[model samples]
Target: MVSSPSATPASALSAHAITAHMGPCAILHDIHLALAPGRWTSIVGPNGAGKSTLLRVLAGLQSCTGSVQLLGRALADWPRRERARTLSWLGQNESAADDLTVYDVAMLGRLPHQAWLAPPSSADHAAVEQALRATQAWDWRTRALGQLSGGERQRVLLARALAVQAQVLLMDEPLANLDPPHQADWLLLVRELVARGHTVVSVLHEVSFALQADDVAVLAAGRLRHHGSTQDAASHRALEQVFDQRIAITQAAGMWLALPRLERPAAPAPSAAAPVSA
Candidate 1:
C-alpha cells in the first residue's frame, strides 16, 4: 500500500490520473504523484517498470491521458519556450554533435533565454561556465565531445542540463557513466541545487544512492507501489517488496544502504549417482 505525501511546501510538480501508452502496450496506469519544492525525489523500480516513461511525461516530452502541472499551472498552458525555461531535462544517452566543443554543447542550454539568432549574452556565458564548473567539466571546455571518454561525455551532458538554470530538473539515469567519485560529486551537486530551492526529480538505478533522496517513489509493472519519505518504514518495505524481497535496507555510517539478500542455493539434490559403499 502507498502512503500519502509527507508534509511539504507547495508541490513543484504534480500528475493526476496519469496514464500513458506506447502503441497498444500500456506503459503506465492511472498514477498520481506530487514532488515537493526545494527537495530531491528519486524514482526507482525494476526493469521495464516505466520509471523513465513517467519522467518523460512529467517533462512534457511524452503524451499521456492525464494532467500534469508545474507550479500550480497546467503544463500544457505554458508556452513552449516558457516551459523549456522552467523545466530542464537530461535524458539517458542523450545525443549531441560530436564536433561541438564542451562549452558550445553546454551553451545550447541557454537557447530558451536567448533572442532568435542572437549571440549568447554575458549571462548565458556565465551560466555555461558555472554549469561546467559544477560538473567538473570546465577544464575540458575546449575539447570536442567525441574526444572525451563515456564518463566525460556524460558530465558534459549534465553540464548542459545544469546550464539551463531551470527551477525543476528531470534527469533519467544521470549517473549512467559516472565512476564512484564522480557519482559522489553528483550527489553533492544535487544537494546544492535543493539547498538553493530547486526541485530535482531523478530516475536512478542505483538503489543505495536513491535512498539518499528526500523522498522515494517506487514503481512496479507501470504502477506506483509507494511514495513517501526515505526514512519511513513503509517506504523501505515497498522498496524491498518491489524487488521481490531480494534486497535488504540497512543503516550504516549514518546513511542508508541497500544490501543484497542472497538466497543460499538448495543443497545440490543428493548426488543422482548411485553411491557405492566406500
Candidate 2:
C-alpha cells in the first residue's frame, strides 16, 4: 500500500539484524541500516537484489525477524496512525480507479488527518494543492484518471503520495514512465524536501540519480555492500563492484555520473568462401 500524506517528528530510523524470507526462500539477511536524520538517502542495487524488500521492511509494511526503530521507539510499538503520520510511501507501478479524477486520488493522502465521514479541512485542501502543484499535476486536477497518459497518471499517483506530507518519505522507482524533464523535476522536489529538513529514502534503478542523494545504501545479492556518503571513494568502488564493473563513476558537470563501460565485440572471423556460385 502506498503511504498517505502526513506530518510527523523528524527522526532517524534504523534496523538491527534484520532478516526477511518468503516461504522457504530468504529475501534479505541480517540487514542493518541507519538513515541520516533530515536528509535524503537512496537504496540502489541490481534487480532481485532485495532493494524494494528492504524498503518495505524499513516502512514496517513487511514482517522480519529483526527489530526496527522509528523516532527512538520500537516500530511495532507505535500506533498504526502514528506510523502513518511518520512514513509516506510511494510504490512502483501503483494503480488507481479509472473513473477517479486526479483530485480524488490525491485527496487520499489526507485521509490520515481527516475524521471518519468528515469533509476535508482547510489544511487538507492546502496540502493537496501544494502536492499537486509540486508534481506539476495541478493542471489536470479535474481530469479522470482513465483519460491521462501513463506519465500523467504517474504524476497523479505521486501527487497522492506527496499529499500525505509525512516526515519520512520512502519511494520505489519514483521516476517510472517520466521523461527526462519530469525526472529532473522529481529530483528537484527531493532536494526541496531535504532542504526543508525532511528525510527521504528511495530505491532507484537509475544509478546517476541515486548518486545525487545525501547518503547511499548499496546492496548486492541481498546484502548491504556499502552505506555512506555518496562522495566517499568507498561508495563508488562498492557501486562498481556490485554491477560487476560494467560501469564507471566519473565527474561530469560537477556531479558524479555512472557511465557504462562496454567491451567492443571481437572482430568477426574472416568469412570462409567455399563453393558459392554467383
RMSD of 2: 6.0
Q: Write the per-residue lDDT of candidate 1 for residues 1-278, one digit (tens) a residue.
A: 01123544378899999999999999999999999887899999999999999999999988999999988789999999988888999999998999999999999999999999999999999999999999999999999999999999999999999998998999999999999999999999999998887899999999999999999999999999999999999999999999988899999999898999889535666758886897
Kindly provide the TM-score of model 1 when superposed on the true structure, using C-alpha atoms.
0.92
Q: Count the backbone clashes (under 3 Å) in each candidate.
A: 0, 6
lDDT, candidate 1, at 222: 99
Report the CA-based lDDT of candidate 2 relative to the real structure.
Answer: 0.89
lDDT of each: 0.93, 0.89
lDDT of 2 by residue, 1-278 (tens): 22323654334789889999988888999998888678899999888999999999999988899999876678899888777877888888889899999999999998888888999999999999999999999999999999999999989999998899887899989999999999999999999988887789999999999999989999988899899999999999999999878889999999998999997546789988899799
What lDDT does candidate 2 reach at residue 89? Answer: 84
Structural similarity to truth (TM-score) of each candidate? 0.92, 0.91
Worst 10 residues of 2 by lDDT: 1-10
Once fitted onto the true fold, the runs of candidate 2 whose alpha carbons sit more than 4 angstroms away are 1-11, 264-278
TM-score for candidate 2, residues paired by index: 0.91
